[model samples]
Target: MLDTQMPTPKPRVIAGESHDWELVIGLEVHAQVATKAKLFSGASTTFGAEPNSNVAFVDAGMPGMLPVINEECVAQAVRTGLGLKAEIHLTSAFDRKNYFYPDLPQGYQISQLYHPIVGEGEVLVELGPNDQGTPTARTVRIERIHLEQDAGKSIHDMDPALSFVDLNRTGVALMEIVSRPDIRGPEEAAAYVTKLRQIMRYLGTCDGNMQNGNLRADVNVSVCRPGQYEKYQETQDFGHLGTRCEIKNMNSLRFIQAAIEVEARRQIAILESGGSVTQETRLYDVEKGETRSMRSKEEAHDYRYFPDPDLLPLDIEQAWVDDLAAHLPELPDAKKARFIGDFGLSDYDASVLTADTTSATFFEAVVAASGNGKASANWVINDLFGRLKKDDREIAESPVSPAQLGGILKLIEAGDISGKIAKDLFEIVYTEGGDPAEIVAARGMKQVTDTGAIERAVDEIIAANPDQVEKARVNPKLAGWFVGQTMKAMGGKANPAEVNRLVGQKLGQ
Candidate 1:
């Protein structure tokens, strides 16, 4: 929940010679529902399939074909709604949004306009650079989440003479999550989308893969005067915000940030030049780094939307919704809180683990197997995560498994292996995949815990460096040098604490 007492930040100000401008932004994120088939037909929804092969007759808009809704897709939307902490309408109907595209075989898309499946959710977005290891947070309200069918892709690059239509993406289920015009800047907009994607992925409602077009966004951007946003928030008046331009189908976060900055500047330039910003649709050209007008924006009336006559209004039972609610997983927010409270983890580490479901799951498994949450967390975050990221592998694709990592941490905890020895054991297990204890035993990686052996090693290092040993007696802080030498002389297998103890005893003499 957002703290109401905290003051909202100043509007996103773009300084100008004549005047300062502010930016207002909203996002309509389209997340492809994770279902086996299309929203309205039984067409396969597999990606990278043969072009037009998976599409069904209804998806192709054949003369006699009628749409019969896929119940599973509807359930997925409901699951997503619950994940967003949104309201699920018991009765919602689909409408035909009439439009023409070379790839849209139906010539109109089936979407929810008048009554959507979900309504009025809130997403708590955490702003990051994570300064001081704590992120600032704000609540971005969701206006609605509606289920709709996707349009096909028009491939223009493949044919220079004519464009090619691939209906492979056609008729896939999409959940268009519309947000309130609460975003004040580009970073916030990207964070909003990211938080939404994270939640949906946790729920298994959407894969949230923006690269594969599994997720995309239409960014609504406008620039207003500095204090106008506060007024808009108070009055809930759409007019208080300036004329917004819709930037279509943004997939990358970096590109989204750049597009917002460029578009805001464009609008600022237009306003400063004595021209009003136009309410229009625009395309972001990545290479040119500018937004160009695509077409005039249309109101709902222009689409001539009507209830999809072939399929009746979808009516689901509250009992079913309740069942889904009961099964909802521990979301990122809850999981993060638990990590901080239970494991004694820092806010930053908790956020990093819970950012993705797989990472959290892996961390928990390591904790369970090792019976040492703190050690497991450090190993997971500092060592395993760094290695996995360097290798460019997902958590699921890691060379080290939870059980294997757990065994290594266990050796460290039991004093069977020193931290330095554990690192060596980790490398061996990561590459060879064997028991940590067995590897430590076979390779003599065990820490030398005997006080007598450690004392002998310390005496040798002291005898070898008498001047340094005298300096350590003069300055107790310099005793760490003796500790290091003793550990090195013992092949780094001596317990660090015992080595420190022996070094201090010999130095005091």
Candidate 2:
């Protein structure tokens, strides 16, 4: 839980020639609920289906086809609310948001307006480091999380004279998480979205795949005087924060950050020139790096929202919500703290491990198998993660499994294989798939742990390079050369610790 009384961070300001303006941001993230079927239809929700192949009669808005709600979507939304530490309303009703689009076969959307399923929640966003180099965080308060149906795609590029509508996504359930205007800048906005995605993914409520439009954010941006935001917070006045423009369907974090900067500057430019910023919906052009007006922002009244006549008000039991709350998975923040405390990892390392469930699960499995938290973290992060990144693969797709990597670490811990030999064994296991111990034994890769053998190898190097040995006696740092030569002469199978001890002992150091 975050302290509600935490100090409001200083506003992020953009300097104009005459005055500096503060940026006020909020996000309405639409996360498609993880369910097998559409919200009001029996149609499959599988992605990458043939265009319009997944549509049901009701989804296509065919006459005399009544809608039926999918109960799993509701449960997923409630689960997400509990994960975010939000209040779940026992009774929530759906409304019809009337609109017209070729992709919206229903001619309007079914959404929650007057009463949302989830009430106020808070998301703790980490904003990198501050002046003192400590991790800085801000709590972005969620206004509501409401469920709605998604519109289909409008394919305009297929033909010069015609546009096509793909109704595959129509009627899919969406959880629109609305946040207050607490975010101060583009970075905070991006962080807020990322944290939401992380939390939802952990809850298994949403997949958070922005590329496939499983998750998207509609950013609300406005510029105000620096202290005006504080006043708005105190007075609860929307006017204090200037007119906000909604940037629609921001799927990429980089694009979200860039859109905020460009939109804030665009608003700043308008206000500085003695013109009012328009309250409208806009789109960010990736190529031009500019925001263009899409349409005037619609108010609730304009959408003509009313209690959805086709469906009854949804009333769920408190016991069901409690049941979901009890079974919630360990979230990112809690997992991160546990990683820090239980594994003795640094804050950054913990953050990296808990950034996603797959990496976290893999690391824990490695730790469990190897019984070395620090070494497991080092191998998983530096070696395994680096290799995965270089190969452009995810942890689930890695060539080396956690058990295999843990086996390699076990060999190192038991002094069965030197670090250099471990790398060679790792390569063989990764590329050819073999047990580390078996490979080490079969290929004579076992470390030369016997002091006598190490001593003989050291003496040979010392005899072959007497001048170097004398120089090693003069400068202790030169002793490393002897260690390297002895290890190489032993085919890198000698224990590094024993080799160092033998080298220092032979040099009388």
> Would you list the C-alpha lDDT of every candidate in the order shown?
0.89, 0.91
Write model 1 residue lDDT over 1-509, tens digit each, in one string: 22333344445689976898888999999999999999988889989998899899999998989998898899999998888889999999999999898889989999999999999988888775343544466788989999999999999898799899999888999999999998989989888888999998899999999999999999999988888887988999989899999999999999999999999999888889899988999999999999999999999999999998888889999999999899989898889889988989887788889999999999999999899888888999999988888888889998898999998888888989988888888888877888888988888888999999998988888899989987888889999998888888889999999998878888884
- Candidate 2 per-residue lDDT, tens place, 1-509, comes to 22234344566889987899999998999999999999999899999999999999999999999989999999999999998889999999999999898999889999999989999988888776666665678988989999999999999899989999999999999999999998999988888888999999899999999999999999999999878987998999999999999999999999999999999999998899999998999999999999999999998899899999999999999999999999999999999888888989988898889999999999999998899998899988998889788889999998888888999999999889877888888889877997788998899988888988888889899999999988988899999999999988988988899899888988999
RMSD of candidate 2 to the true fold?
Answer: 1.7
Highest lDDT against the true fold, candidate: 2
Q: What TM-scores do the predictions have?
A: 0.97, 0.97
Over the full model, what C-alpha lDDT does candidate 1 score relative to the true structure?
0.89
Kindly report which residue stretches of model 2 are placed more than 4 angstroms away from their true locations once superposed.
Answer: 1-10
Worst 10-residue stretch by lDDT in candidate 2?
Answer: 1-10
**Candidate 1 residue spans exceeding 4 A from truth:** 1-10, 129-134
